[model samples]
Structure formats: C-alpha cells, structure tokens
Target: MSRVDLKVVLLGNAMVGKTSLMERYVHDSFNCNRPYQNTIGTVFAAKRVQVNDVTLIMGIWDTAGSEKYDAMTRTYYRGAKAAIVCYDITKSSTFQRAKHWVRELRSIEENCKVYLCATKKDLCDEGFVSDDPDIQNVVERYASGTQTKLFVTSSKTGENVVELFDEIIQDFISNPENLQKVEEAIVLSKKTGERYCCAI
Candidate 1:
C-alpha cells in the first residue's frame, strides 16, 4: 500500500485565528471566544482525504505566533509540503507581517505551495471588500512579488477554506511523477543503510 504524506503549517502574527480555522476543519465546530493557547513549539491535527484513487494523509501544524517563540517555531517549518500564511483583514499590522513569513518559507522550500489568507472577513466592512481595485491591487502585488496565491477567506463563515485544501491536494495529484520519485528515493536510501532528508 502506497501512502502520500503532506504537512501543512499555518504561520502569521498572533491572534489571527489560525487555530480556530484549524479546529473548524478538524472538529467541524467553532468557538467565538475561546482562550488563546500558545503553541509552545507546534501542535498538529491530522486528517485523511480521498483524492480520486489516492489517499492523502494531511498533517497540519499550528505554530505559536509570538515574538518570543519565533526561533522555536521556525524549526517546525522544516519538511512542510505546504503552508498557509494568515493575517487579520481588520488588523493591518498582522497583515503586514505575513510577507515576512512567506519570504522565510520560500527561502527554505524551493517550490513550497504558499497560500496567503486574509482571516476574519466578518469584521471587515464590505466597503473594504478585497475585490475592489485598490484592495485587489495590493493583494496582487504582494502575491506576485512573494510567489504565493492571495485569497480572502472568512473562517467564521466557513468560506473558501475547503477549496483551499482542495486546490492544494489537486496540485499534489497533478504531479504524479513526483510521487514515483519520492518512492524511488525512499527505496534507494533504505538500501544504503541511511536516510536522506532532501529527497522528499
């Protein structure tokens, strides 16, 4: 039996609802005022999705979004297949910090799939809907420059969140050749009596 593994991590400034979005997917429930728990290093949720004939086992890691834990959190980025950089639409400070996280992820993973998400849209005014020329312009510039897909989502309303994961899994399936390469490398490394980290 062949199993495909994926690790998705969320990175951003604190209080952007990263954990809330995660819980909504993993548990199908939401809490409006749950106490914020700092993920000391990395806390994870796992789910398996059936994509056609393949089963993708996704492991999502939620990182602590605190300045004091920055050094500790970077270690969790290692071996990630994809990442979602989240920011609060109402808070420009958190929005601005997303670029730094995106840059850091790109530096380590040559082709890491990066998704730029604007969280908490329910709080923002429709007058400021991101599709507006001014807003879309900003998102476009940032996404293009950073090599990421910019998307506006409301985790509270259960919007676009599922599509985000669907697209990511589709991208993985689109590359059938990579899976064979991964398996081949795994077999070769095992015979050599050692492990190679970069092959995946």
Candidate 2:
C-alpha cells in the first residue's frame, strides 16, 4: 500500500483535556482519575490508519496550553495538515480560548483544516448544553465563518474521539483538491527554506 504522512496538532487552554483527547484517540485508552498536570512543552504520538489504498501515518502533537509555553507551542503549528482546537464544554472560558487557538492556527497554517472540538462531554449531563446563548452563538458563528468542522468528544468515555480523526482522514482522502493544496503548501514551504514541524 502507498504510504502518506500527515501532522495534526491539538490546541486549547490549560485543563481543557487536550492531552486526554490525544491519548484517547491515539491509544484508545484514557485514565479518568489521573491527576492533572500542565503540559510543559508538547507531546508527540503517532498512529497509522488505512484510508482506501493508502496507509496514513499521523503525527499528532499535543501542545502545551499554558501562556509560558505559548512560544514553544507556536513552533509546532507550522505545516500541520489538521488542527483540533479543543475546549471544555463546562467552561465557557475554554471555549473562548479555543477561538483564539483557531485564529492562531489560521494565521500560521492557512491551508490546515481546523476542527472545533468541545471536550469533556461526559461532564455535561445533556452532552454540551450551555446556559449561555452567546457562547453557542459565538461557537457556531466562528465555525461557520471559518468553514471548520465542530465535534463534541469525551476522552473518558471514548465518545467521538476516533470518529473525529477518522472524519478528517476520510475528508482528505475524498477531497483531492484539499490534498493537493496541502501538498502544494508543503512544497512551497520547502522551497522557501521554511521548516515544517513534522517534516520527514
């Protein structure tokens, strides 16, 4: 089978469950009772999945969400094929931070697919119900305006975690135009002597 490689980044504020999401998707396992510790810089994981006749190796980066590591995190955004900007459904502030993550990803990687991920769905009894209409409005508006996919996922419950990555991979496989754009971007970056985070 033909082999392809892609980079995916997860971004959000601290305690937004970015690490848990990555762990769940990459390993199909998560520890619900684990103590929370801030990601100092970034963590990397790799997973391989077959889409059609192609074997895709995804290099997933779980970036640090704290302000101290913001500079370090920005370096990993370049040349990513997809970005998951995650937020805690129970915390409106994380949702707002997710928006900022989206903007940052766009500014650095224009052609990268951005996914608005509402994390920790298990905590919400009704699965992402928000009392604030403005929060919903902002999330919907931003996603629509940016033409990004939005997903509600729970790392603890394994809800939609695999589905999210599968959807992204399938979308790329189905859309030749998008795949071409990503390839062109990679070539352009190489020609300009710019380094892609997951270049290999």
Candidate 3:
C-alpha cells in the first residue's frame, strides 16, 4: 500500500472543545466526565486511514488555546497540510476567535487548506447551523470568502465526526498533485535529514 503523510492542526479558543474533538476523531471515544484541562504547548496524535490503495497517516496537532500561547501556537502551523479552525456553536465569542485563527492560518500558511468547524452541535437543538444569522453570515461571507468548508460536528454524539475526517482525506487524495507533493517532500526530508514534527 502507498503511504501518504498529512499534518493537520486544530486552532481555536479555550473550552471550545478542541481537545474533545481531537480525542473523538483519533480515539473514537469521548470523556464526558473529564475535567477541563489546558493543552500545555501542543499535543499530537496520529491516525491511519485507508482510502482506496493509499494509506493516509495524519499527524494531528492540538494546540493550547490560551492567548498566552498565541506566539507559541503559530510555531505549530509550520508545514501543516490542513488546519481545522474550531468554534463552539453556542458561543459567539468562540466563533469570533475562530475567525481570527482562520485569518492567522491563511496569512501564515498560504498553501494550507482550512476548514471551519462548529463544535458542540449536540448542544444546539434550535435548528441547523445556517439558522443562526450570525453564524450563517460568517460561514457565507467570511468563511466562504476564504474558500473554507464548514462542518457541524458533535464530539459527544459522534455526529459528523467521521465524515469530517473522511472529507479531509478525500480532499488530499482527490488531487494527484497533492499526493505528489507529499511524496516529494518526504524524499527531500530524508535526503536532507530534516525534521518536520516536534522541531519547535
């Protein structure tokens, strides 16, 4: 089987469920009773996914959301293939923070693909995410303007969790050039003995 490596980073405000989302996606488990704990600088988890003949090994990095770590968080963005900017659906402030992250990621990593993720979807029983005027405006006017796709996910219920990651993997594999670029980078890294992960 052919192997493809992808580095993905999660960026968002504190308590927006970045850790929970990562756990649910990587481990397929959710700790509902777990106390809130801050991610110190960055934490990583790898999950291998099979799409057709290619094996996708995604190195997902979860960064601390506190403002104090803003400087350090940007360091994790280097060489990232994709970024998931997360926001809590129930909190407008978190969405605003998500926007900032999107902009920052775009500004820094111009080649990186961005996905806007709305977390805690299970908490919102009102209607679809589009029903929220503020979120809809941001999704359409702001997120769409950046060519970002939005996913409404609930880590608690496992809703849209697998679909979200599947879509990401598909996007990477759908393009022949994307896979070529990854292969070329791996070759170059090996030749130069360069370290891509945890070098910061």
TM-score attained by model 3: 0.83
> lDDT tens string, model 2, 1-200?
22236788999999999999988887778996789999888998877666655445678889999878888888998888899999887788888788888887778788788999988878775556665546656777778898989988899999999899988888666768756755665566557875333222
lDDT of 3 at 51: 69
User: Over the stretch 21-108, how does candidate 1's per-residue lDDT look in tens digits?
Assistant: 7876766667877777766667778777776655456778899998888888888878777898998776667767888888788888
The TM-score values for the models, in the order shown, are 0.80, 0.81, 0.83
Worst 10 residues of 1 by lDDT: 191-200
| CA displacement after TM-score superposition, residue 147 of candidate 3 (Å) | 2.1
Q: For each candidate, what is the lDDT? A: 0.74, 0.80, 0.81
Go through the candidates in order and give the C-alpha RMSD of each one to the true structure: 5.9, 6.0, 5.0
Q: Quote the lDDT for 108 in model 3.
A: 82
**Per-residue accuracy of model 3 over 114-155 as CA lDDT, tens digit each:** 999989888775464533557646666776677789898999
Worst 10 residues of 2 by lDDT: 191-200
Ranking the candidates on TM-score from highest down gives 3, 2, 1
Cα distance off (Å), candidate 1, residue 14: 0.8
lDDT of 3 at 100: 90
